[model samples]
Target: MSFTTRPTLQGTFGMVSSTHWLASQSAMGILERGGNAFDAAVTAGFVLHVVEPHLNGPGGEVPAIVATARDPRPTVLCGQGPAPAGATIAHFRSLGLDLVPGAGPLAAAVPGAVDAWLLLLREHGTLSLAEVLEPAIGYAAAGHPLVGAVGATVTAVRSLFEQHWPTSAQLWLRGGRPPVAGERFTNPAYAHTLRRLVEAGQAAGGDREAQIEAARRAWGTGFVAEAIDAFSRRPFRDSSGRAHAGLVTGDDLAAYSATWEEPATLDWRGHTIAKTGFWGQGPVLLQSLAILDALDDGAYDTASAAGIHAQAEALTLAFADREAWYGDSADVPATALLDPAYARERAALIGDRASRELRPGSPGGAQPRLPDHVRSRVTHRVDVPDPTTGEPTVRSDGVTRGDTCHVDVVDRWGNMISATPSGGWLQSSPTIPELGFPLGSRLQMCWLQEGLPASLVPGRRPRTTLSPTLVLRDGEPVLACGTPGGDQQDQWQLPFLLRHLVGGQHLQQAIDAPAWHSLGVPSSFYPRESEPGVLLVEDRLDAAVVTALRSYGHEVRLADAWSLGRLCAVSRDPATGVLAAGANPRGMQGYACGR
Candidate 1:
């Protein structure tokens, strides 16, 4: 019955899995050297920045769920950066832009990934700063094999980089060309940047925590801040096809800091799911679970047409609520929206035909102020042809569903973390030559229109799609899992949990099961577009099941067998103290390591 390419690796020591093999190996190496999960994750996170530059960077954001052995209750580490103080709706509108550009300095948010990983390492880790950073520094200073996808992503926009982002060209291009895939590409400048951060930590005459705090200060208020400010002054072409100066300043970086927050949780079928609060899209899983929990029997085959239809409908309803209520603002009635009663009410709207509208109902009369783009029946189709392929760069509309990165780790001591890090991709903005990294374009998720929860507001987070999930069985932490797909992160992950928890499958079996996600809702990126009644599924599913789904009013599109998701998971059995891990094989890069 196993369709997996690799067996579920079980061990008594530790387990680490991620979107990239180098990161996973680096983490396992840390574990072998007696470092805890937090330290191992720090090492892996840094390496991920170097190896998967197109997916994430040091100038990105990572929101993580951390669970400890002593305290089984999970905690959310909010590393997602907020909008700069100068990033206001009026400021963007004054530039004659309707939506924030998806790529460029204008869409930059406060970079928070470096500080967040450092904070986790300083607080919960057993290793020194240098130990946690050594691997990534080596890979950057020397060289690491560049993956094909990274090369392709860079190639896709190589012409743009040469024309608009020369700083990016200087860093990414070898002989004015994209680095060859699988070649040993080195970033000595990036290594020096990390070295400076390490030196800052070493100079501070205090404990490990104090030193790490000093490093964070260096990143925010020191040379790094100055470099970011100077580079953003140069106008760059963005998704709007217009060049504009960015708004990020040194004060914006100084004013921000990573935080620890409470996670939203709910018990279902002997397991408790923990996710980020309303500021992110995590609660959609909780809400969807609520609706699914109300089903007559919870024992349906997940691969069946009935199961697929039910999950898609529930996700559609939940994402509708996301568009209306979920954001960084306090206007969101998160408690009421996640209520089982409300979920039951919403679930009642599911019909034989797929929902083709953005139907957000009243939650305590919250009166959802959804954006016109999200609710418009009229499609504002704008085509931007890619110079490289002579085809539309984006889809039917002007948006591309961008993605991020993830890492999951569970230690022998019962500590675990599931983190989704993204935003400041290499392709996001021009690289700051002095700092060797670019600022994140997360501000693009914010809307220019007012009165909505995700409205563009200075000093507030932009309601990111970067979400990670942790599962606890009977009040004890067991699983840390996540994936990398813009709005599809949770949708792609839900089925894995369903197959594992509902169908009693192993971790790898769950991960390797053909994945699919609904792209029916409006995308969260700039130039947001919606594809109503669309369901993108993998061809691995039974042909009959696919046909039956089409019969139920879904606009089915069959993707390659392993094209939909890049999920990774790590689980620790509370009773046996044994850990198991799995990674997606669709992309040749993902890896799982244990024992």
Candidate 2:
């Protein structure tokens, strides 16, 4: 894609991206068309599906949080599609299946993204759905350039696409091969779907029901439940051997519908942050913030080294607790995890030194502490061959990557939309005929154990890594930030945010700064279970810092400085009314614009 960077003369807005330039251009188009930030955001979301299908689409679950100038209080929209009411852990057990990986009809949930966008538009948007969707429709129909990120992703996942669904292979792979950068990629089927949505939306006159029906037609229906059934079958395999078709079918598509609920809000250290509890890892963020707030503010400044350490320690502890106790709130005591007293108790237990080992249950509760001075263990790394070259590449950990796109916008009226639409990596292999987009492989994120909290259950939401955040100063919107990195999302975001908010780094500087991550013991992904206490730092970090951390008894691995999440954000100065926007330089082309 062509790369052109120019500042917007009107109101300033920034786009951080991991997709292509066309996707970013789509959002700018919405702004130019007199649409508000929310409208532009929704438009961008739809466009990304067509331009960057490997990352996300209409069939994916979206967990988003939005802030409007009129209502400074941010609201968390549950863009997650819920598991079918008929799905259950027992069903899988009956079929003698333990784990379900990748996208399939069975992994599908009640997709809420389209409906969520409609709701946001209805509540605070200035443009019609038809208006917001025009860019996506046009791009999908006319085609766009395949930029670096899109080309790289396609090259990486081409094999999976070819083996899973014929239609997908037909669309993504040309002559049974992935296209390189600069290739013109077109999705006439997807384009037609977008056109239908626009046409139906235009005719609906803001009637949500009519618009949703139009979306259903555009995106095929009744595949969610069918996908579940396929998962219940033994030796799960589709007719193509790369996908499971029985688990997803046309009937399941008909039953799927998005739900709207009141957003969940939490007050942390006097800051009110909103997150959707209906699905995803939102509750984890809320709970983690609560635990952080319960601790001494002195322990967690954004700039101080000690503060950064404390923040990492706290997040690790919270994530550990999430793995152990967090699940579908409807089936568990989710609120208990957020209890202030419990959080304080948990924070008090974290010692200054590393724990050396993992403690399975709540470390703050009655669970015994892990052994002291535990020896580190390393496991054999598996080498998976690159689809295109047959060259072996190291698969660091087997944790399935989560695919998503994040956008944060602020309009002339001060309205802001911060959202991340995601699906765990690997869309279902077999395309559902006319749907165009693959259903999410979200079920793969769930643990296969019999008694675990995240075990499959009907209507339960997976603990997602997507976190869309909005920062406020004196009860007004100031910054909106988010990223896409599966579980690593918040882990990286927390540090970046602290650096920007507390370290006083400018927006672009904070995003451009080097970072580090800890894949502690009892690792979530495979091939590295015993390899705990390993700290992966961006190469840009001072060599001294790496040595110092190693001195503290940690295994440090150096990675490319820009190996972390893709960030997109916009900050509005309440005092000056000047909006500053910055896109991550490491990702695809992103820009800032407004009037």
Candidate 3:
């Protein structure tokens, strides 16, 4: 039953797995230095920003699920920034735009990743700020080998950068061309930007916590904020093929900070699953699981065709609810939507045929009010050239900043974390001269209309696609796992969860299994589109299974084997205090390290 090409790495001290090897190495270095899991994770997070610029950047946002040794309960660290005060429906419409452009200053949200990482380190880490940031600074200053995907992305958008985003041209283009794959690439300006944070921390002249606070202030109200404010007035080209100035100002940056909240949880089959609130798509997995859990166990066997059908049908229905109900606004009926009784009722909708219709049921006897954008003409412009690949990875609008990355960490102390860090890709917007990074286009997830919870509003966080998962057994965290597939983040994670928790598969075995996601719901990103009755499954499945799925009226598309997900998972055994980790082999960029 093992599909994994590599065995899971097991250790007793610490474990870290991430989308990039350098990031994984950086975190392991901290653990070797006697730092805790929190310190190791934050270190990896920063390294990912420097090494995976096409996938993420320092100006990006990260929504993480953390369980500290002191506070064993899982909680979400909300790094997803809100829209600027000046970003209003009236102004966007005045610009002659029906929807915000995906990659431009106009689509930027206040950068929140820096503050969020610092906040986590300050509260739970045992390492000094200098210690944690040293590796990232070194790589950005000296150089790191660029990956092929980044080079391809840069080449694809090279002309755009040269024609309009001159700053990006100066930073990314080496010899006026995209850097060659495996070529040593350097970003001195980004190095300086990171150095400034270190200096600000040292100037505080107190304990580690106080120094971190000082750095956070410098990022929010000091130099970083000033730089972002000055750039807001400069117009730039966007995905809409129009140039427009962004509205984020210094005050917007200064007024904002990342916060911590208890995670949304669901208990079934003796294990507790933790996820971010409706503000993210984490609960879609919860709702889907609820539907599957209510059925006879054998009916959802992932290895069999029947199981795959049940999972896909349940996800289609649940994600329809995501389109119809999930959002960041207070108007979301999260509590009622997560109720078991409601989940059972929703489960009844699953049938033999692949559901081509968008069906969101009433929760607590209230009708779902979907946004006008979703109900409008659903376009078929997919960002990816084929079913196997695309920007924002698997499921999102054709318009987006770029793709995303993920990290998972666990320590001997039982602390575990799963984090998805994305947005503000180097290709998203022009690079700030001194900061060497662009603003995030996460605001594209918001709707322009009112009434829906995801309506565009100043100071409200967008319904982000960055999701991480933490699973607990008997009220203790046992696993921290996630991936980088935009709207498919949770969709891809669902099969792994079921295979591991219920199907008795090993962590790596589960991760290596073929997976699929429905594209029937409205995308979270701008220029949203949906394909009815479409199911993208890995080609590794048996020909009979593929044909069976097609017989169910699904427009089955064969995805390249090992091309579907970039998933990584880390597990800890409370009884023996042993830690095990696994990393995806699909991209050949992910790694797991522990000792």
Candidate 4:
């Protein structure tokens, strides 16, 4: 009846949504083959690695929130690997560096996405490892159409590939030129690597779990780990314009394993929202929800200027706490930070006008200390803008950047999952010729400061920006959603939740709505810059609303009409056996499929 970019797909069987169409189709195919949501999701995850190589790869990391049909409680699948055993603040400072480089092996964590996916398959999935990996392997070996963004990303970093990372040049450039958009591009090396993993799994015989474990061992302790260790030892150029060897080794790879953990959850307006722990930026969403719930119902009106101001201000407060306290440490005051009293105190700080200061509240009278890089706004220069080098931004400069990828799947049996897989872009680091992928630069999120929550430490997970969300209603899993923006992942989801959960909009209508996010908190990416009072909004929002936002002492910047959010979501109705899905139309890549 009303305008929407596409219909919110409704069916009785299954639903899948992802950043790319090929991945969406592959997942739907798995579901059609009688596989459950976990199997479909694993298929999509691997296919995404092949198709969206500019955004994610086999060497990256992923974190997912999942709920099984049998057990309807949310659980976090932590695929985010930790800093290597040798990665210490002292070691970095001794190398004449104040912060990790944005793009190099020195910024790499142990590869985690592949292991994490395998773990999920081994524990929850119904299909064999080879069965789920088939689509990605086929795409890699037989060639898939290169998207325009991927081509442009390669062109932007062509000089770097040619001069410093020749191995990368060899893989990405054919006949001394970057692949053209829409042309079929093949990566035989990646295909071979995946096929070898399948062989390793098959060699273990017909036990699905054992087969998966064998493949996991092959990745961790066998040839894959050896290749990474040897290649990372070579000096490579990074964001700092210097050549440095990485700290990762075969031991780091062998020691790391994807684990399952309890999620940080908050109940609001009869719906329970779940996210990863303080180690990720996921809890910031929960904190923001707590702050918003403390306000009047009128504040939930996402289409209004006053409501937008309220949401941005609340997120600003939550992200400030993220900077001060959130990390992969036991000392995080998470319980106190999510207390109702703390939310009220934080809510009371929001005013009619935007606040330009970074204010982190004291939870339970504890002192909140922010890192020096955040407090002093220290920044470093990067010569080239790689796809995953920095936070997702709408810059006035001609620099191009890419962030992450997301997939959400829901099956007929009530199995649901939301995963954000990212890092290890083609330009993140030099590609390993044998593996056909580069190590992820996730350590760029850590600071060199000692005694801080996010300080670089051996065997500690870097505080990551990858956050996926799952929601339950009436004791059943109802919604799974996430996006790929660096710091804005949760910021964008806030308004979507408000519109759909409270305002009662259709899934597609909610996703098609104009989006905005605050840049008031320290970024979780390289250089870690923060803009105190800035808010970026899609220009499609009411012109009068933009004027009103500026009147509220907010520095508002207008982006293209559909450029703010790249979110994907899927939902299941327990009462009616109905499934629905939606995908962002911003990039013209994301797709949603269902029966």
Which predicted model would earn the best lDDT?
A: 4
lDDT of each: 0.84, 0.59, 0.85, 0.88
Per-residue accuracy of model 2 over 1-595 as CA lDDT, tens digit each: 1221333223454332323456667777777777777778878788777766656777676766676776777677776765656556666556565554434455556555766676667666767667777778777777777665555555655655565445556766778677777777777776766676667555656675566555555444423334323443423233123334334334444555455455555665545666666245656566656667777775556444445456656776776665666566334455566778877876776666655455444533544222111123444332334211111121212123445667777776677767887652334334443445556656655554555556666556665667787777778887777776555566667767666765577776777667666666333322223345666677777777666566656677777766655666677877777776666655544444444
lDDT per residue (tens digit) for residues 265-310 in model 4: 9998999999999998999999999998898876788999999999
Q: Weakest 10 consecutive residues, lDDT, candidate 4?
A: 391-400
Candidate 1, pairs of clashing residues: none
Model with the higher lDDT, candidate 1 or 4: 4
Clashes by residue pair, model 3: none
Off by over 4 Å in 3: 1-3, 381-383, 386-401
TM-score of 1: 0.96
Lowest-sum lDDT 10-residue window in model 1: 388-397
Top candidate when judged by TM-score against the true structure: 3
RMSD of each: 2.7, 5.5, 1.9, 2.4
Report the number of clashing residue pairs per model. 0, 26, 0, 1
Task: In angstroms, give how far residue 535 of model 3 lies from its true place.
Answer: 0.5
Predicted candidate 1 versus true structure: per-residue lDDT over 1-595, tens digit per residue: 7667899999999999999999999999999999999999999999999988888898889999999888889999999888998888999989998889888889988888988998899779988888889999999999999987767777778888888888888988879888888989888888999999889988997578878888899999998988887887889888888788888888888988899999988888889999999999999889888888776553245888888898888888889899888998557887788787887888888877787888887887667777776767434333433211111133211133357889999999999999998877888888888777888788888988887889888989989998899999977889999998888888987888898888889988998787777767777876777678878788888999899999989989777777768889999888899899999887778899989
Structural RMSD, model 2: 5.5
lDDT of 3 by residue, 1-595 (tens): 4447788899899999999999999999998999988999999999998889888888889999998877778999999989899988788888887777788899998888888999999988999999999999999999999888777777778788888888989998868998888999888988898899889989998688888999999899999899989987899888888788988899998899899998889997898999999988889988989888877786569878788888888888788888888887647788888898998898888778777778888999888877777777386847574445433432211145356889999987888999999988987888998998888898888887776778778888888888899999877899999998887888889899888888878878888888787776577776777777778888898889999888888888888887888889999988889999998888788989897
Model 3 earns a TM-score of 0.97
**Roughly what TM-score does model 4 have, to 2 decimal places?**
0.97
